[model samples]
Target: MRYSNYIGIFAGLLMIVAAVFPWISITSIDAVVTGFGSEKVTRFGMPVLMNLFMIGLTTIFFLVPKLWAKRANPFAAAINFSWALRNLLLLSTCRNGECPKTTIWLYVYFAASLILLVMSVLPDMKVIEKGKE
Candidate 1:
Protein backbone atom coordinates (compact mmCIF):
# COMPACT_ATOMS: atom_id res chain seq x y z
CA MET A 1 0.00 0.00 0.00
CA ARG A 2 3.04 2.27 0.21
CA TYR A 3 4.08 4.48 -2.69
CA SER A 4 7.05 2.22 -3.24
CA ASN A 5 4.76 -0.76 -3.40
CA TYR A 6 2.66 1.01 -5.98
CA ILE A 7 5.73 1.92 -7.98
CA GLY A 8 6.92 -1.66 -7.88
CA ILE A 9 3.54 -2.89 -9.01
CA PHE A 10 3.46 -0.28 -11.73
CA ALA A 11 6.94 -1.11 -12.92
CA GLY A 12 6.18 -4.82 -12.84
CA LEU A 13 3.07 -4.31 -14.93
CA LEU A 14 4.89 -2.09 -17.37
CA MET A 15 7.59 -4.68 -17.81
CA ILE A 16 5.11 -7.44 -18.45
CA VAL A 17 3.17 -5.33 -20.89
CA ALA A 18 6.26 -4.16 -22.69
CA ALA A 19 7.59 -7.67 -22.92
CA VAL A 20 4.34 -9.22 -24.07
CA PHE A 21 2.64 -6.48 -26.04
CA PRO A 22 5.21 -5.89 -28.75
CA TRP A 23 4.13 -9.03 -30.52
CA ILE A 24 0.48 -8.15 -29.98
CA SER A 25 0.73 -4.39 -30.28
CA ILE A 26 2.60 -4.74 -33.54
CA THR A 27 -0.56 -6.03 -35.10
CA SER A 28 -2.42 -2.90 -34.13
CA ILE A 29 0.51 -0.74 -35.09
CA ASP A 30 0.83 -2.41 -38.45
CA ALA A 31 -2.87 -2.09 -39.02
CA VAL A 32 -3.14 1.59 -38.18
CA VAL A 33 0.31 2.72 -39.18
CA THR A 34 -0.75 2.51 -42.76
CA GLY A 35 -2.59 5.75 -42.79
CA PHE A 36 -4.02 6.80 -46.14
CA GLY A 37 -1.74 5.40 -48.79
CA SER A 38 1.34 5.79 -46.69
CA GLU A 39 4.41 3.68 -47.36
CA LYS A 40 6.06 4.96 -44.22
CA VAL A 41 4.96 2.07 -42.01
CA THR A 42 6.56 -0.41 -44.33
CA ARG A 43 9.75 1.58 -44.33
CA PHE A 44 9.95 2.33 -40.61
CA GLY A 45 8.08 -0.38 -38.79
CA MET A 46 11.34 -2.13 -37.95
CA PRO A 47 12.62 0.97 -36.23
CA VAL A 48 9.49 1.12 -34.15
CA LEU A 49 9.96 -2.52 -33.23
CA MET A 50 13.43 -1.75 -31.99
CA ASN A 51 12.05 0.98 -29.75
CA LEU A 52 9.45 -1.39 -28.36
CA PHE A 53 12.13 -3.90 -27.57
CA MET A 54 14.10 -1.29 -25.70
CA ILE A 55 11.06 -0.15 -23.75
CA GLY A 56 10.36 -3.75 -22.85
CA LEU A 57 13.90 -4.22 -21.64
CA THR A 58 13.64 -1.07 -19.56
CA THR A 59 10.55 -2.31 -17.76
CA ILE A 60 11.91 -5.79 -17.22
CA PHE A 61 15.05 -4.35 -15.70
CA PHE A 62 13.04 -2.17 -13.38
CA LEU A 63 11.00 -5.12 -12.19
CA VAL A 64 13.94 -7.32 -11.33
CA PRO A 65 14.23 -6.07 -7.80
CA LYS A 66 11.87 -6.96 -4.99
CA LEU A 67 8.97 -4.65 -4.21
CA TRP A 68 9.49 -4.28 -0.49
CA ALA A 69 12.58 -2.18 -0.91
CA LYS A 70 11.98 1.46 -0.31
CA ARG A 71 14.22 2.57 -3.16
CA ALA A 72 14.60 1.64 -6.81
CA ASN A 73 17.67 0.13 -8.30
CA PRO A 74 19.42 3.18 -9.68
CA PHE A 75 20.53 1.73 -12.98
CA ALA A 76 17.47 -0.44 -13.45
CA ALA A 77 14.95 2.34 -13.03
CA ALA A 78 16.54 5.02 -15.19
CA ILE A 79 15.13 4.87 -18.71
CA ASN A 80 15.37 7.60 -21.32
CA PHE A 81 12.00 8.05 -22.97
CA SER A 82 13.58 10.52 -25.32
CA TRP A 83 15.35 7.69 -27.07
CA ALA A 84 12.12 5.88 -27.79
CA LEU A 85 10.49 9.19 -28.67
CA ARG A 86 13.03 9.82 -31.40
CA ASN A 87 12.32 6.40 -32.86
CA LEU A 88 8.56 6.86 -32.68
CA LEU A 89 8.83 10.39 -34.03
CA LEU A 90 10.99 9.25 -36.90
CA LEU A 91 8.67 6.34 -37.59
CA SER A 92 5.80 8.80 -37.66
CA THR A 93 7.63 11.28 -39.83
CA CYS A 94 8.65 9.59 -43.04
CA ARG A 95 5.55 8.60 -44.91
CA ASN A 96 7.48 8.52 -48.16
CA GLY A 97 9.62 11.37 -46.86
CA GLU A 98 6.62 13.70 -46.82
CA CYS A 99 6.33 13.84 -43.02
CA PRO A 100 2.69 13.15 -42.44
CA LYS A 101 1.67 16.32 -40.68
CA THR A 102 -1.93 15.27 -41.16
CA THR A 103 -1.73 12.30 -38.81
CA ILE A 104 -3.34 12.68 -35.38
CA TRP A 105 -2.68 9.13 -34.17
CA LEU A 106 1.04 9.66 -34.50
CA TYR A 107 0.68 12.38 -31.92
CA VAL A 108 -1.43 10.07 -29.82
CA TYR A 109 1.21 7.38 -30.01
CA PHE A 110 3.84 9.95 -29.17
CA ALA A 111 1.92 10.99 -26.08
CA ALA A 112 1.44 7.38 -25.03
CA SER A 113 5.14 6.75 -25.56
CA LEU A 114 5.88 9.63 -23.22
CA ILE A 115 3.58 8.18 -20.59
CA LEU A 116 5.31 4.82 -20.84
CA LEU A 117 8.64 6.54 -20.50
CA VAL A 118 7.45 8.31 -17.37
CA MET A 119 6.23 5.00 -15.98
CA SER A 120 9.59 3.53 -16.80
CA VAL A 121 11.14 6.00 -14.38
CA LEU A 122 8.77 5.38 -11.51
CA PRO A 123 10.75 2.46 -10.12
CA ASP A 124 13.78 4.71 -9.91
CA MET A 125 12.18 6.75 -7.17
CA LYS A 126 12.90 3.83 -4.88
CA VAL A 127 16.59 3.78 -5.77
CA ILE A 128 17.00 7.52 -5.56
CA GLU A 129 15.89 7.39 -1.96
CA LYS A 130 17.25 4.00 -0.91
CA GLY A 131 20.08 2.82 -3.16
CA LYS A 132 22.71 5.26 -1.92
CA GLU A 133 22.72 3.78 1.54
Candidate 2:
Protein backbone atom coordinates (compact mmCIF):
# COMPACT_ATOMS: atom_id res chain seq x y z
CA MET A 1 0.00 0.00 0.00
CA ARG A 2 2.95 2.28 0.59
CA TYR A 3 3.58 2.39 -3.11
CA SER A 4 -0.01 2.34 -4.27
CA ASN A 5 0.26 5.62 -6.18
CA TYR A 6 3.26 4.40 -8.16
CA ILE A 7 1.54 1.13 -8.94
CA GLY A 8 -1.62 2.95 -9.93
CA ILE A 9 0.34 5.15 -12.30
CA PHE A 10 1.85 2.06 -13.91
CA ALA A 11 -1.56 0.48 -14.31
CA GLY A 12 -2.89 3.62 -15.97
CA LEU A 13 0.01 3.62 -18.41
CA LEU A 14 -0.54 -0.06 -19.17
CA MET A 15 -4.17 0.58 -19.95
CA ILE A 16 -3.23 3.34 -22.36
CA VAL A 17 -0.84 0.99 -24.18
CA ALA A 18 -3.31 -1.87 -24.21
CA ALA A 19 -5.96 0.28 -25.87
CA VAL A 20 -3.99 0.32 -29.09
CA PHE A 21 -3.94 -3.47 -29.59
CA PRO A 22 -6.62 -5.63 -31.11
CA TRP A 23 -9.36 -6.51 -28.69
CA ILE A 24 -11.40 -8.98 -30.70
CA SER A 25 -11.79 -10.53 -34.13
CA ILE A 26 -15.15 -10.99 -35.76
CA THR A 27 -15.04 -13.89 -38.17
CA SER A 28 -18.37 -12.98 -39.73
CA ILE A 29 -17.21 -9.58 -40.88
CA ASP A 30 -13.52 -10.47 -41.12
CA ALA A 31 -12.64 -7.50 -39.00
CA VAL A 32 -10.51 -6.81 -35.97
CA VAL A 33 -11.67 -4.45 -33.21
CA THR A 34 -9.59 -2.32 -30.90
CA GLY A 35 -10.56 0.25 -28.30
CA PHE A 36 -9.86 3.10 -30.70
CA GLY A 37 -11.37 1.45 -33.76
CA SER A 38 -14.48 -0.72 -34.04
CA GLU A 39 -16.97 -1.82 -36.67
CA LYS A 40 -19.77 0.66 -37.36
CA VAL A 41 -22.35 -2.04 -36.81
CA THR A 42 -21.26 -2.35 -33.18
CA ARG A 43 -21.91 1.38 -32.58
CA PHE A 44 -19.68 1.35 -29.48
CA GLY A 45 -18.16 4.74 -30.27
CA MET A 46 -14.65 5.86 -29.21
CA PRO A 47 -13.86 4.21 -25.94
CA VAL A 48 -10.11 4.71 -26.24
CA LEU A 49 -10.23 8.49 -25.93
CA MET A 50 -12.59 8.40 -23.02
CA ASN A 51 -10.46 5.86 -21.22
CA LEU A 52 -7.35 7.91 -21.85
CA PHE A 53 -8.96 10.98 -20.33
CA MET A 54 -10.10 9.07 -17.26
CA ILE A 55 -6.76 7.36 -16.73
CA GLY A 56 -4.93 10.64 -17.18
CA LEU A 57 -7.12 12.26 -14.55
CA THR A 58 -6.59 9.32 -12.19
CA THR A 59 -2.84 9.50 -12.65
CA ILE A 60 -2.85 13.23 -11.90
CA PHE A 61 -4.87 12.64 -8.76
CA PHE A 62 -2.44 9.96 -7.65
CA LEU A 63 0.42 12.41 -7.87
CA VAL A 64 -1.41 15.08 -5.83
CA PRO A 65 -0.49 15.01 -2.15
CA LYS A 66 -3.83 15.80 -0.62
CA LEU A 67 -6.64 13.99 1.16
CA TRP A 68 -9.17 15.23 -1.39
CA ALA A 69 -7.10 13.94 -4.27
CA LYS A 70 -6.89 10.50 -2.69
CA ARG A 71 -10.61 10.52 -2.03
CA ALA A 72 -11.41 11.47 -5.63
CA ASN A 73 -8.99 9.01 -7.21
CA PRO A 74 -11.12 5.97 -6.42
CA PHE A 75 -14.10 7.48 -8.17
CA ALA A 76 -12.15 8.16 -11.32
CA ALA A 77 -10.55 4.71 -11.26
CA ALA A 78 -13.92 3.03 -10.72
CA ILE A 79 -15.37 4.82 -13.74
CA ASN A 80 -12.37 3.78 -15.85
CA PHE A 81 -12.72 0.19 -14.68
CA SER A 82 -16.42 0.19 -15.51
CA TRP A 83 -15.71 1.54 -18.98
CA ALA A 84 -13.11 -1.20 -19.54
CA LEU A 85 -15.66 -3.84 -18.55
CA ARG A 86 -18.18 -2.35 -20.90
CA ASN A 87 -15.68 -2.48 -23.75
CA LEU A 88 -14.78 -6.09 -22.95
CA LEU A 89 -18.38 -7.26 -22.88
CA LEU A 90 -19.51 -5.31 -25.93
CA LEU A 91 -16.55 -6.33 -28.04
CA SER A 92 -16.60 -10.04 -27.20
CA THR A 93 -20.35 -10.70 -27.12
CA CYS A 94 -22.03 -13.02 -29.61
CA ARG A 95 -24.40 -11.35 -32.04
CA ASN A 96 -26.81 -13.23 -34.29
CA GLY A 97 -25.10 -16.53 -33.45
CA GLU A 98 -21.62 -15.20 -34.24
CA CYS A 99 -19.20 -14.88 -31.37
CA PRO A 100 -16.09 -12.75 -31.64
CA LYS A 101 -12.74 -14.19 -30.61
CA THR A 102 -11.25 -12.19 -27.75
CA THR A 103 -7.57 -11.24 -27.90
CA ILE A 104 -4.97 -11.06 -25.12
CA TRP A 105 -4.81 -7.30 -25.11
CA LEU A 106 -8.50 -7.07 -24.22
CA TYR A 107 -7.94 -9.05 -21.05
CA VAL A 108 -4.80 -7.09 -20.33
CA TYR A 109 -6.76 -3.85 -20.55
CA PHE A 110 -9.34 -5.15 -18.12
CA ALA A 111 -6.69 -6.39 -15.69
CA ALA A 112 -4.88 -3.07 -15.72
CA SER A 113 -8.08 -1.20 -15.03
CA LEU A 114 -8.91 -3.53 -12.17
CA ILE A 115 -5.45 -3.05 -10.70
CA LEU A 116 -5.85 0.73 -10.99
CA LEU A 117 -9.11 0.62 -9.09
CA VAL A 118 -7.57 -1.46 -6.29
CA MET A 119 -4.57 0.82 -5.98
CA SER A 120 -6.75 3.90 -5.88
CA VAL A 121 -8.84 2.41 -3.14
CA LEU A 122 -5.73 1.76 -1.08
CA PRO A 123 -3.88 5.06 -1.44
CA ASP A 124 -0.88 5.52 0.76
CA MET A 125 -1.25 8.42 3.19
CA LYS A 126 0.00 9.36 6.60
CA VAL A 127 -2.62 9.90 9.29
CA ILE A 128 -1.79 12.32 12.05
CA GLU A 129 -3.03 11.75 15.57
CA LYS A 130 -4.84 14.76 16.97
CA GLY A 131 -3.29 14.46 20.43
CA LYS A 132 0.29 13.67 19.29
CA GLU A 133 1.01 17.30 18.40
Candidate 3:
Protein backbone atom coordinates (compact mmCIF):
# COMPACT_ATOMS: atom_id res chain seq x y z
CA MET A 1 0.00 0.00 0.00
CA ARG A 2 2.30 2.73 -1.17
CA TYR A 3 1.42 6.22 -2.33
CA SER A 4 2.28 5.30 -5.91
CA ASN A 5 -0.29 2.53 -5.96
CA TYR A 6 -3.16 4.83 -4.99
CA ILE A 7 -3.57 6.37 -8.41
CA GLY A 8 -3.81 3.04 -10.17
CA ILE A 9 -6.29 1.78 -7.62
CA PHE A 10 -8.46 4.88 -7.99
CA ALA A 11 -8.28 4.72 -11.75
CA GLY A 12 -9.20 1.05 -11.72
CA LEU A 13 -12.18 1.79 -9.54
CA LEU A 14 -13.30 4.63 -11.83
CA MET A 15 -13.04 2.36 -14.85
CA ILE A 16 -15.08 -0.33 -13.16
CA VAL A 17 -17.74 2.19 -12.26
CA ALA A 18 -17.74 3.70 -15.72
CA ALA A 19 -18.29 0.32 -17.31
CA VAL A 20 -21.81 0.24 -15.94
CA PHE A 21 -22.65 3.61 -17.45
CA PRO A 22 -23.55 4.44 -21.01
CA TRP A 23 -20.64 4.73 -23.42
CA ILE A 24 -22.00 5.65 -26.84
CA SER A 25 -25.48 6.60 -27.91
CA ILE A 26 -26.62 6.62 -31.50
CA THR A 27 -30.07 7.27 -32.81
CA SER A 28 -30.94 5.79 -36.14
CA ILE A 29 -34.46 6.36 -37.42
CA ASP A 30 -36.62 5.16 -34.53
CA ALA A 31 -34.00 2.91 -32.98
CA VAL A 32 -31.34 3.74 -30.45
CA VAL A 33 -28.02 1.97 -29.92
CA THR A 34 -26.30 2.23 -26.55
CA GLY A 35 -22.98 0.95 -25.28
CA PHE A 36 -24.55 -1.90 -23.35
CA GLY A 37 -27.22 -4.13 -24.80
CA SER A 38 -27.54 -7.52 -26.42
CA GLU A 39 -27.71 -5.79 -29.78
CA LYS A 40 -24.68 -3.54 -29.25
CA VAL A 41 -22.61 -5.77 -27.00
CA THR A 42 -20.02 -6.23 -29.70
CA ARG A 43 -19.42 -2.50 -29.85
CA PHE A 44 -18.70 -2.24 -26.13
CA GLY A 45 -17.14 -5.64 -25.51
CA MET A 46 -13.52 -4.68 -25.90
CA PRO A 47 -13.70 -1.76 -23.51
CA VAL A 48 -15.23 -3.94 -20.85
CA LEU A 49 -12.65 -6.63 -21.37
CA MET A 50 -9.82 -4.14 -21.15
CA ASN A 51 -11.30 -2.57 -18.06
CA LEU A 52 -11.53 -5.91 -16.32
CA PHE A 53 -7.99 -6.79 -17.31
CA MET A 54 -6.78 -3.46 -15.92
CA ILE A 55 -8.59 -4.07 -12.67
CA GLY A 56 -6.99 -7.49 -12.33
CA LEU A 57 -3.54 -6.22 -13.08
CA THR A 58 -3.87 -3.28 -10.71
CA THR A 59 -5.02 -5.61 -7.97
CA ILE A 60 -2.06 -7.85 -8.60
CA PHE A 61 0.19 -4.84 -8.48
CA PHE A 62 -0.91 -4.23 -4.93
CA LEU A 63 -1.11 -7.81 -3.72
CA VAL A 64 2.01 -9.23 -5.33
CA PRO A 65 5.06 -7.05 -5.60
CA LYS A 66 6.65 -9.31 -8.19
CA LEU A 67 8.68 -8.28 -11.21
CA TRP A 68 6.08 -9.71 -13.55
CA ALA A 69 3.38 -7.65 -11.86
CA LYS A 70 5.47 -4.51 -12.21
CA ARG A 71 5.97 -5.19 -15.88
CA ALA A 72 2.33 -6.03 -16.44
CA ASN A 73 1.06 -2.79 -14.91
CA PRO A 74 2.47 -0.70 -17.73
CA PHE A 75 1.17 -3.01 -20.40
CA ALA A 76 -2.28 -2.93 -18.85
CA ALA A 77 -2.12 0.84 -18.61
CA ALA A 78 -1.19 1.07 -22.26
CA ILE A 79 -4.08 -1.11 -23.24
CA ASN A 80 -6.44 0.97 -21.16
CA PHE A 81 -5.11 4.18 -22.65
CA SER A 82 -5.56 2.85 -26.15
CA TRP A 83 -9.00 1.61 -25.35
CA ALA A 84 -10.01 5.01 -24.06
CA LEU A 85 -8.58 6.73 -27.10
CA ARG A 86 -10.34 4.36 -29.42
CA ASN A 87 -13.65 4.96 -27.72
CA LEU A 88 -13.19 8.69 -27.68
CA LEU A 89 -12.32 8.75 -31.36
CA LEU A 90 -15.00 6.37 -32.42
CA LEU A 91 -17.84 7.99 -30.54
CA SER A 92 -16.82 11.51 -31.35
CA THR A 93 -16.43 10.95 -35.08
CA CYS A 94 -19.21 11.42 -37.58
CA ARG A 95 -20.30 8.46 -39.61
CA ASN A 96 -22.58 8.89 -42.62
CA GLY A 97 -22.91 12.59 -41.75
CA GLU A 98 -24.00 11.94 -38.20
CA CYS A 99 -22.01 11.69 -35.02
CA PRO A 100 -23.07 9.64 -32.07
CA LYS A 101 -24.07 11.41 -28.88
CA THR A 102 -21.54 10.63 -26.17
CA THR A 103 -22.33 10.66 -22.50
CA ILE A 104 -20.30 12.10 -19.63
CA TRP A 105 -19.34 8.58 -18.66
CA LEU A 106 -17.26 8.25 -21.80
CA TYR A 107 -15.23 11.30 -20.89
CA VAL A 108 -14.83 10.10 -17.34
CA TYR A 109 -13.67 6.75 -18.62
CA PHE A 110 -11.06 8.38 -20.79
CA ALA A 111 -9.86 10.54 -17.93
CA ALA A 112 -9.54 7.47 -15.75
CA SER A 113 -7.61 5.69 -18.45
CA LEU A 114 -5.25 8.58 -18.82
CA ILE A 115 -4.75 8.68 -15.07
CA LEU A 116 -4.01 4.99 -15.08
CA LEU A 117 -1.39 5.48 -17.74
CA VAL A 118 0.35 8.22 -15.81
CA MET A 119 0.17 6.28 -12.57
CA SER A 120 1.58 3.17 -14.19
CA VAL A 121 4.68 4.99 -15.34
CA LEU A 122 5.15 6.97 -12.16
CA PRO A 123 6.16 3.99 -10.02
CA ASP A 124 9.55 3.26 -11.55
CA MET A 125 12.25 2.81 -8.94
CA LYS A 126 15.59 4.51 -9.24
CA VAL A 127 18.73 3.10 -7.74
CA ILE A 128 21.35 5.56 -6.45
CA GLU A 129 25.07 4.90 -6.36
CA LYS A 130 26.88 5.22 -3.09
CA GLY A 131 27.17 8.88 -1.94
CA LYS A 132 25.01 9.99 -4.83
CA GLU A 133 22.24 12.47 -4.02
**Whole-model Cα lDDT of every candidate shown, in order:** 0.43, 0.89, 0.69
**Which lDDT tens digits does candidate 3 get at residues 1-133?**
2466787788878877876787666676433333333254354444466567666776677456566777778887887688778767866677788777777887888898888887876675545699877
Where is model 2 more than 4 Å wrong at Cα?
Answer: 39-42
* Segments of candidate 3 deviating more than 4 angstroms: 29-46, 124-133
**TM-score, each model?**
0.44, 0.93, 0.75
- Using lDDT, rank the candidates from best to worst: 2, 3, 1
* Residue-wise C-alpha lDDT for candidate 2, range 1-133, written one tens digit per residue: 8999999999999998998888888887788778888764456667777789999999999999999999999999999999899888878889899888989999999999999999999988998999897
Q: Output the worst ten-in-a-row residue range by lDDT, candidate 3.
A: 29-38
Top of the candidates by TM-score: 2
If the candidates were sorted by their TM-score against the true structure, best first, what order would they fall in?
A: 2, 3, 1
Best-matching candidate per lDDT = 2
Which regions in candidate 1 have their CA more than 4 angstroms from the true location? 1-42, 66-80, 91-102, 124-133
How far does residue 28 in candidate 1 sit from its true spot (Å)?
A: 23
Give the true-structure RMSD of model 1.
7.9
Question: In model 2, what lDDT does residue 89 have?
Answer: 82
| Residues 1-133 of candidate 1: C-alpha lDDT, one tens digit per residue | 2244345445444433442322211333443332122342454444344445554555555556666432333333333345445645554454433443324444444455555545544543433566666
